[model samples]
Target: MKHDIVIVGGGVPGLTLALALAQSTSLSVAVLEARDCVRLFKRDARVSAITQASKRIFKKLGVWSAIHAQAIQSFTRIECWDEAGNEIDFHCETLAMSALGYIVENQAIQFVLQEALQSYCTAQIFYSTKLIALHEKEDAIMLSTDTGQVFHAKLVVAADGAMSFVRERAQIILDKKDYNEEAIVATITTTAMHEQIARQCFLKTGPVALLPLSDSYRTSLVWTLPTAEAKQYMDLKPDDFCKALTCVFSKRFSEVVVVEGRQSFRLCKQQAQQCVKPRIALLGDALHTVHPLAGQGMNMGLLDAAALFEIIHTAIAHHRDFGSHAVLRRYARWRKADNFPMSVGIDWIKQLFAANTPVISLVRVSGLQILNRFPTIKNYFARYAVGERNGLPKLAQ
Candidate 1:
């Protein structure tokens, strides 16, 4: 089989890119997914905070309405504080937007994108198919799958995730940092209503975030802790876990009555040394991974997809090879400029908060207090958070 583009991994990024191209361009696209379509719809306890820019991208693809109909929790305010009693608050009113962002289940986004692709997309998706080897030729790249299928494409995209087979096969070096921490994720019903607000508390150990859900009393929790400490928390009974969590959260939510889908994963930051090579391009977690303290990972991946789509669309309009190094390099430079600084900023914030010394705490608290007092500066950060930065792709606008 041959196509103009082949995307490895049918996750949100790959599927979004495939759908975008299929809807707006004439490229013959294909997606290689290692799991069956039914498996993709299984309940994913994880949720993502979709930025305004990402929402617009989905809207352009004509699937945002379907996704919104399924499930969505819109939050207009964000409150973050430290143990020192210093807090910073952000409101959507600062940007004249109705909502700062929407929190949606990861599975919901994936299901909607997959359904849209299957129903009307010209692109083809192959389930139970995995890329085993890829070789780049002068005019096209050859991909071999575990199912003994061979595919040729003018361009190949690696959205397979952090442990990307395509990235490894391409020999892209990754700069990595292990924070020696694990993030405990769960869905909990609290005694107090979240009031459509997203909240985060910085503890001596790490940060814990409560993201508002559709239900007034339900929120998603992401608590970062040292690896060993995380295991101890995971081993506790649900009641005991809730008690400990409530204490650490300063009882802001009153009490965590029901905790479901409790799980933890190690935390790390990784960046590929190069995002593109000849006919191959990397996006999403394959290109970079950041601390989730800000809930920007999914949004970042969405932007990457949108940006790449715009670049390729322009190339095709000019009758240039979209897979050429010249065209791919443009994408690499564009994303690196936007993604690199954000990655570093998130990592820095994580490290700054992780330190609990009196002086360090004082400095951070003072910084938060100062920033909170200045609405203009706070609004600047708020704008960046909602993906209102300049140079956004047409889809995001």
Candidate 2:
């Protein structure tokens, strides 16, 4: 069988990309998911901090209304402070918006995207199917699935995770940095009302972010720390874990209760040397993985998808081969240029906070104080976080 595009992964970015293309054009899109249908439809425990730009993309795809209604939590303010109380505050009112960003469950996004895809005739989701072999020819790309089926496509996309099978088979090299840290994620109940605000505290270990959830007093926590320490935290009893968490940010809330079980994953900073080659392209974590200090990982991946969709629109308008080197190279140039600096900047911030020397700590505190005093600087950073800028894709704009 043949398709216009074959996506290797059925994750959010891949499903979103297929939905975007299917809604606009008559592209025959097939998503090869390795998991069974039951597993693919199961609710995910993790939630992603979706930026305004990504929300706009979802809106354009006509999936935002359903996702927003399902369980999206909007945070209007962000308060980030160091351990010594030096803080920088960003408010949506200062930027003339209703929300800084949104907290969306990964399962909610996938379910919405999947439902939307079902409405389109051009999209197909093949469950329990995995791409075992790929062959790129002069015209179309060929793929062999675990089910012993062969499919051909003009373009292939790797929306798989950071350890992308397609990216590895395509021979794309990645630049990687081991953070030597693990992020523990879970939902917790706090004594204080979050009041539609997201708060983060910088500690010698790493940053702890309490993102607002639909429940007033409950928040989703993403705490980063050393791997060894993270293992210890994971081993603690639920009540003891809550006590330990309360001790870390004792000033913010009176009591902390772990309403959900804990989940831990190692953090790393990685970027592909190139995002595309011939008929192959990478999006989301498959292309780049950034430190989650700013909660930009999923947003960045959505932006990558948006950018590629825009490029494909132009290619089709001009009757150019969408999978040709000329087309893929343009995507690579646009995305790599946008993703490289952001990845590096996030790594720098992670390192800056990781340093515990007395002089560095003093400097970090002073910098936060100064940044807080300057509204202009703070607003600029806020705008960046919201994905508002010139030259962005039409959806993001």
Which candidate tops lDDT? 1
Error of 2 at 310 (Å): 0.9
| Model 1 per-residue lDDT tens digits across residues 259-339 | 999989998999999999989999999988899999999988998999999999999999999999999999999998899
Q: Return the TM-score for each candidate structure.
A: 0.97, 0.97
Candidate 2 error regions (>4 Å) = 38-44
Whole-model lDDT values for every prediction: 0.90, 0.86
Model 1 residue runs over 4 Å out of place are 39-42
Worst 10 residues of 2 by lDDT: 36-45
Q: Give residue 349's lDDT in candidate 2 (0 to 100).
A: 78
